[model samples]
Target: MASATVDSGGIGRASLFLASGTIVSRILGFVKLIVLAGMIGAYGDSADAFSIANQLPNTVYVIVAGGILTAVLVPQIVRASQHADGGTAYINKLLTLALLILTITTVVAVALAPLITGFIGLNLSSDQLALAIAFAYWCLPQMFFYGLYTLLGEVLNARKSFGPFTWVPVLNNVVAIAGLVVFAIMFGADPTGSRSAGEVTPAMVAVLAGSATLGVVAQALVLFYFWRRIGLRFRPDFHFRGVGLRATGRMAGWTFGMLLLTTGAGIAETQVATLATGQASVFVLATAWLIFMLPHSVITVSVATAYFTRMSEHAALAKFDLVKTDASSAIRGTTLLIVLASAVIAVCAYPFAAVFVSPFDQIVGIGNVILAFIVGLVPFCVLFVLQRTFYALGDTRTPFFFTLFQVVLILLGVLGCTQLPVEWIAVGIAGVITVSGVLQAALAAVLLRRRLGGLDGRRMLQSLVKYLTAAILPVLLGLSLVWLLGGTQQGGFAVSGRFGAIVSMIAVGLVMASSYFGMLLLMRSAELQAFLTPLRARLRR
Candidate 1:
């Protein structure tokens, strides 16, 4: 495998491209969620029903798009590039095999909608199950399209053409949002979550779930143009002689196990969450998870994704030291921002929830859940880098062991959560999740350190200590400002109205950002410069 030369700032510029698209895509994503919440109340049974069903596509898709594609495809494609045909026949065969799997999976999943719905939403009442099953039928097809998008888009990344992969999600959001608007006009709003399963019509499901599915279709199909530009032609190559599933399965075996473990934990969480249905349960958990992922997606994901290619290149050349350096830098660099973002999100949680749901108790419910999830931001980000680093090193077995360990702990803890009072159940589950994340990260660090003989652990620890110190003043100031606006109190200035929440959140966030960055600058934090150095080098270039 050939290693491409990419200077420091080059990765930073690449991150900028990724982050810019993520920012827009996330904004639209939030918009879509807000609309969905308005359509069905955030804590309502109807909301839980839809959220539960809707999650199936994403859960199945993550197992495919997020896990297997990266685990198997990119390296496979990169290796195939050595052939005289430039990997065309290999890619076509691989693509055909991939689509075939996705198609079968989608069909089977749709056929088993009721059982799948029951598995995740374990405690849903009969009515909720009925409605969720209906939505599942329409939404399950997204598994195929998401896999398509991942297949086409990841090949582009392997080819060093990365723009379309990031940009296409904006279209998905736009299309979904438009469909939501039409659904509102036809079906009317149900912000109170009072819409019963019986009230749901075929038209309602079509406009709602159908729009969501169509968005993914658009996202996947749009990649064909980019594929053509990269000099690839589409053909349904059914000849699967040398390109056999056994080989691919062998390669993806550990990752597939990791995926099942990860989803098992999620199913446990979702089932436990269902116990709090019509309270601060399923829908709130989903919303809070979405919000929790925002900073990670924008900062950690963007930065690490940029660094992954470089690390893989180094790993391919057997440059373990450079791979170690990239992984270390990614963890530290992302954490420097993550700690501050965590502070802001913690302080602004109520107002943030107010952006989506209107009820004061519901706003507080989401806020509490966010606080619970935000506690593990650092560890979560750390684990992300380590997992991707393992992938880059072509070792999925380690991730599986660590992931298996965490999922077991999480399942045990979730079992404990069922005993909590209803109001506290969601928070308990979130806390369990956060704790598992922290422990998993520590385990992953030890393993990677052993494998690489040390991942600059001492320096990384010092950076973490310095970042925690820098975040203290910002967190304090953010808390003080939030208290002033009564962010936690129902009918208070920040939570009284959406506009007020927006204004208060922006004000407090700015103050926190200024104080946090200023403290980092005064401390002469090298971790902070990890991000800046790249952009500065890129600008000069």
Candidate 2:
């Protein structure tokens, strides 16, 4: 049997679990968008208002997530696991502290909803700003529950319960979708975004934002079940003296600072995007971002997440070679798929956008944003791996500098975007972010290389070149199929309706995958065989 160090099988299985869950979650997420767009319409005042409000919690969650879930929790927990008491004492203390912070943060966020709304939606009209504040009052409470989910989920992830972390989001989406259906039944649909901020009623606010919060509550609470199954119990431990939490705090402090910089940049992006609020700005950017995240979430995140725990373990033991090996493997594996995904998705951008919104201009709006965002997809994944590699090595300060570097770039680029046409503002914001991501990833890789002594650069470059070469034909084929279906033309089959868009996207995706796979097969790519090898083994068994 292969040594556990070389046991790609375990990571592959974990990746499969993470990917499968992410795939379902993202699909439901798209469905939720479809329902949301149907109810409020994309690019409408109400949609942008709600989008701004809803995104507030996510922004807050990302802030909380930047430190604990991403940087501090796993490495610390992996270290604590070797304690004589099995780390229960550390877990209890950490959980108690995280929840306390979350509760305080949530209350404060809810109280300052108006202030938060004003800041994020600085340039909105009074009516729209008022609507966003109203929704934020209801929606910002999700900040606590979102933190709750991450706090618990990260603990589970530290314990290697990866499934529930990714799977529970499906429940969140399902509950939210059910709420959308009932909301539509009660209030009627507005898929064309005909409703303006002034037209929204209190009852509408209660149901829509309320249900969204409820979904987050459910998502956070359900993790306790998995927590129990894994034989972990939680108690409120307040004696925070000596369980090694000081070090955790030190790690989280740097991560928090880094994420604050990132959040500032996000705030800048939102403020800039809001300049063209009525013309595919805020809501369009939100929608386009969700589309852009699907492939990253499913492939890059799944693979990177699986590798993270392993890296943490190896790093705790000062095993840099294994960490280097895992990092390279993760980067190469994710890049291979991301390259293909980026190419195909960019080609099918219009059709994919058509599935969410019907208006030709809106489809084009979202499609253009997709193209802008997807250009950075490969680097985005690379950064994901590189950052985690740093975190795995228990170094948060370095990641902060690189993140700060990107944030500065983003802020400057977003300011420049304000001079562009209103219709192009969202696309410009996305393009700026993509460019910043590419630059950040490069800086991170260089930093990581200096620290790790090397990152298998020569082989990684060769594989990257190979993957790009292989994707050329598939990209051309996807573009041709898009043209054949007239994806860019209004009322064409690919953009005519939701049904046609789905069919066209599916057909085009299959053709592209086949061509890409054929190319890889001819080259005998290790990445391709590694993907197939597990499935082939399962079949034989």
Candidate 3:
């Protein structure tokens, strides 16, 4: 087995590598989204149908094994590594059991695809519902591959091999992009989602859904090469008895509950969005969500994941102080980036959103949603790190309770959203997400303090204050530039063509980022310095 011990700065280095991969993957993902937007306009039935169908598998995957594989498996694998056989037996058994569960779930889900599609797309028109069901038939099978990818990735993470997991998603995006390109060439762009079920061909369905499933299959299969390189061999072992299944079950119990509440809230949100403003609203919300997740996936997830294994090891060794120290560093690091990102996103929401959606109206809709969602980004990052800290400590119950409270708030928010004007429903949902994020962050902070005996509250608050202060000038500068260059337009830069829009966004984004970092440097922010130290050293080398 590989050495379980990591170097003192290993988490930071690992986070950098993971962050780099995420940056590349996100760039590709953005291109893929752009391609998708061109193929199916941001607000339409087809876009909504595909988004709903695609998202359902992820929701089901989370409800079933996502939490277990993510929160429960790593710590167990870490514990099992101490055995004479290097946890091979434990790994094999766990893999076998997960595969069995995933296979069964996928079969059942596919068989019930129509029923599931009806529930998710209950507000859709007959044509939209039929298309969604057709997509679900192909997309539902992705649950198995999603499970396989997570199971393999978690094992890699437990062994301190993080790159393969982060980098592999690029392939998934590439495959999807290629498929979309082909579809565009064949069927042309369907910006209005006006394509009827009768017009849809089997070849189109195969290219669309088949390519998606193929990408996941490739993602899961690529890990085997890495597993071999690391000297780990997979063997089919069904001896699930007395192999730590009980402990995993116990951990998974709380996690499953948490997932249930979270997925319930998501379903409610989707239903509200769809019911309030048709399928277009769902697509708008999804587009905004993808942008919202960019910073979280690149910075927060990378930092939290890199720190988690180390934190778990510290907990195992009873080094509570070290765990606290790691958590503090991760929180500070993540907050620094997310705060800045949130500011930039909020200030430049319209122009940035204009890059994705065509037509002035759709751009305005998406931009409004983006602005509302951006306010929650920092708090959302905080919640993410705190949850991982709890998971690292082998305490999933506390996070679940806090999450349940957040979900209840979200459901109430969704209900309130249903009362809004059709045009504003997406914005209302975004507001709900923002409010819930703040509440969740506050609750998680208080609970985590009790769990950790004190979470350095003064330091965290100071960091938040300093980062926000530094961000103010950059945000103002970005907004002023947008106003001067793009005018007070509602949708996007009053640019003529796609090329012009792309150029305008790039220029505006560069100025914002440069000014933001410059302000941080001028403020002599310790977090900024810490973040840049490795880059400086690499330059010197």
Instruction: Please tell me which predicted candidate would have the highest lDDT against the true structure.
Output: 2
**Per-residue C-alpha lDDT of model 2 across residues 1-541, encoded as one tens digit per residue:** 0111113458887887788899999999999989898899887789989999999998887787535566889889999999999899999998898888888888888888899899999999999999999999989888888888888888888888888889899999999999999999999998887788898999999999999999999999998888888899999999999999888888888898898999899999999988997787888898888988999999999999889999999999999999999999999999989999999899999999998888899899999999999999999999999999999999999999999999999999999999999999999999999999999999999999999999999989999999999999999999999999989898999999999999999999999999998999999999899889878988999
Error of 3 at 46 (Å): 0.8
Worst 10 residues of 1 by lDDT: 1-10
Q: Return the TM-score for each candidate structure.
A: 0.95, 0.98, 0.96
Worst 10-residue lDDT window for candidate 2 reads: 1-10
Per-residue error for 23 in candidate 3, Å, reads 1.3
Rank list by lDDT: 2, 1, 3
What is the per-residue lDDT of model 3 for residues 1-541, given as tens digits with 9 covering 90 to 100? 2222245768777887888889999999889888888887777677888888888889999999998789988888988888889899999999998899999999999999999889977788897888888888889888999999999989998998888889888989999889998888888888665666567776777788888888888888888888886888889899899778888889889999999999999998888888754433887888899999999999999989888888888888888888888888889989988887887777667766677765667667787899899899998988888888888888888988998999999999999988988889889988998999899999999999898898988988898888888878877887787777662475435333366566766676788778878888888889889778987999999
What are the RMSD figures for all models against the true structure? 2.7, 2.3, 2.1
Report lDDT per candidate: 0.86, 0.90, 0.84
Whichever of 2 and 3 has more TM-score, that candidate is: 2
**Model 3 poorest 10 in a row by lDDT:** 487-496
Question: lDDT by residue for model 1 over 145-233, one digit each (tens)?
Answer: 89999999878877766677888899999999999999999879998888887788878988899999999999999999988876778
